[model samples]
Target: MTKAGIIYVVGTPIGNLGDFPPRAQTVLAGVDLVLAEDTRHSRKLLDHFQLHPKLQTLHEHNERELAPRLISRLQAGESMALISDAGMPLVSDPGYILLHAAREAQVPVRVVPGPSAALAALAASGLPTDRFCFEGFLPPKPGARRDRLQALAAEQRTQIYFESPRRILDTLQDLADCFGLARPASLSRELTKIHEDTLRGSVGEILARLRDDPDSCRGEMVLVLGGAPAPRDGPELAPVLLPLLAALPLSQAVAVAVQITGLPRKQVYAEALRIKED
Candidate 1:
């Protein structure tokens, strides 16, 4: 009787090949197969480390149909490593389905930590990292993107998102409008690469810089927005909320007025109290 092989979740560099973890090489060389978001992209890493395996492309498109095939190999005592085009796998990338199937088949699973663009950018951002959230990407439509930012307004924790070079300005504009034009932000690009740069400033300032000198940014980018740390409880809206409460019932106007500012009633109530006093 033979034991089933394990599936290793390997993390790779987003840009600089030098960031590749030494353990990633060892695991890949030991695996019988490699599941990658893009075989060609993974090839560059493989060449750099002088390690190779039977690489297979398993992205969003073919995940449903191809997962079974990979599982069959796993049952055959073949261990495999799953990697994304950049950073960690299934983080704004694919391979979740395969991972799910692997577990269902009782195959062993292990992770080899590597570089992450989200962490790389967030750290270089010089923004709040004690607590953060990864938004991935906003909707492509300008209106939708703006709506999304408005939704996340007052999130409190720093927000990190991925965006294409072409859409950087637009996304920045939306965040500026929703989070406030003067909201501090950082635009990090080619992190770990020779041209790695984390341009930091208010949203408006960064937007202006990127617009004036487009060449300053290339490749992928991570946008970090400083969020007000989540209020321990909720916001104390009593001040601003008090005035409205005096004019109308607390329950009726609490939601309506807070809608525009995107603050909780507790926060608005605290503001309401201040409004009533003055």
Candidate 2:
């Protein structure tokens, strides 16, 4: 009787092909089948390594429907490997459904770790890595994105997020508005590539840099924002909110101040308006 073959959740290189581990290559070559987030993208990786396995599409759209069948294959002593287009199989990528299904079926499951953009950026971000949170991607809509940032405003641990090149400036502006212009942050783009770069400073500084240098706005970006400062033993309102009223319109100032202070909008607005009157 044959034993069940293990399901390998593999991580691939985010950029440099040389980052692909020997173990990952062996697994991909030896597997009975390989599940890829994007077959076309993974195809190039496989071809480069010259290790072709049966490729099947298992992305966010089809992973649920295909998971059961894939799980059955694992149960039947057919080893399989799962890979994303880049980075880990399921870090802001797909393969969760099938992995969960495999676990439920009591099939052997394993992970062959490789490169991760989150960790890559965080390590070089010059922020506190001892405690940090990975916020994969913000909502694309402005209102929703700001709302999310507002919710995370007081987070003490450093925050990491994945963002598109085109949206980086807008996101940085939003970060400045929500976290305050002085909030420390880092932006790393095209990690491990020839043009890989990291910019560290206040959110406003990075925003200005990117705006002036359009060349930096052409690749995937990882954003790391410093956590809010510890609360002082006093009314945490005036020092933070009053200045915004001086710098911006009443409503706009209140909106940003509320996000930064986590205070009630009505109260901030009233105070801002009073500041304007005074």
Candidate 3:
């Protein structure tokens, strides 16, 4: 039986080549094959580092078909690396199928971590990063996009999204409409490149700036939106507390009720006991 080979899910720079780690360079250079979302685009990165490796396309359209063949190659003991055009693979990018297949086959997979546009934007955005969610790209069609935004209107965690230059303005308009004009947001574009710029303001203000300066809309974009504010009034407790107390142990029920109601644990525990007594 032939020993299987390893798959390295490498991360490339989003913009500045300087952000590419040395470990990523070594892995890419040593790998027998490099699976790229775009062979043409990835070739430039390889050439910049003076490294030559076999490049193959593994993008959205062909990933499902290509994954099985690639897995066979790995089983045959050929080491491979997977990379997107920028950032990590499988982040609003392709490669999930291949990675999932590799895992099922028990092939060893490793990550050569590096820059991510979403992380870079969020870090620089000065928003609450303690608890956040990446929403990737919103729906492209107007109605679908608006519907999606409407669904996320109540999301409490800071949200990150990737947007294209062509759709930035329109997306901002919809974000303002759905999330409210005064909601805080940060728009970071052309990150890590010389012309990198991050505009932080209310959704409406950022929308106004983009309209005033069309050039800002160019290049890769990441939008970070503040979460919904906590409700001012606490919800009435009995309806929330009674069911939990009945179904769960007193302590467990109180803990869950606290999470759901955003009320003090002590208060929830007291209410739990009172309801039990009643």
lDDT per residue, candidate 3, 4-118, as tens digits?
A: 3999999999999999999999999898999998999999999999989999998899999999999998998999999999998899999899999999999899888889999
Candidate 3 global lDDT: 0.86
lDDT of 1 by residue, 1-278 (tens): 11248889999887878788777888888888899878998898798789878898888999999988888888888888999988899899998898999889887889888889999888888888998999998899998887777678768889999999888888876765555456678999988888888899977789889889979657788899888435433244444455566778755555545544444335544555555566
Q: Give the range of the ten consecutive residues with the poorest summed lDDT in model 3.
A: 258-267
Q: Provide the clashing-pair count of each candidate structure.
A: 26, 0, 0
Candidate 2 structure quality by residue, lDDT tens digits, 41-142? 999999999988999999889888998988887888898888999998888988888888888899898889999999999998999999999999999999
Best by TM-score: 2
Question: In order, what lDDT does every prediction score?
Answer: 0.79, 0.84, 0.86
- Model 2 scores worst on lDDT over the 10 consecutive residues at 261-270
Query: Which model, 1 or 2, shows the larger TM-score?
Result: 2
Query: By TM-score, highest first, what's the ranking?
Result: 2, 3, 1
| Cα RMSD for candidates in order | 5.6, 3.7, 9.8
C-alpha RMSD in Å of predicted model 3 compared with the true structure: 9.8
Pairs in clash, predicted candidate 3: none
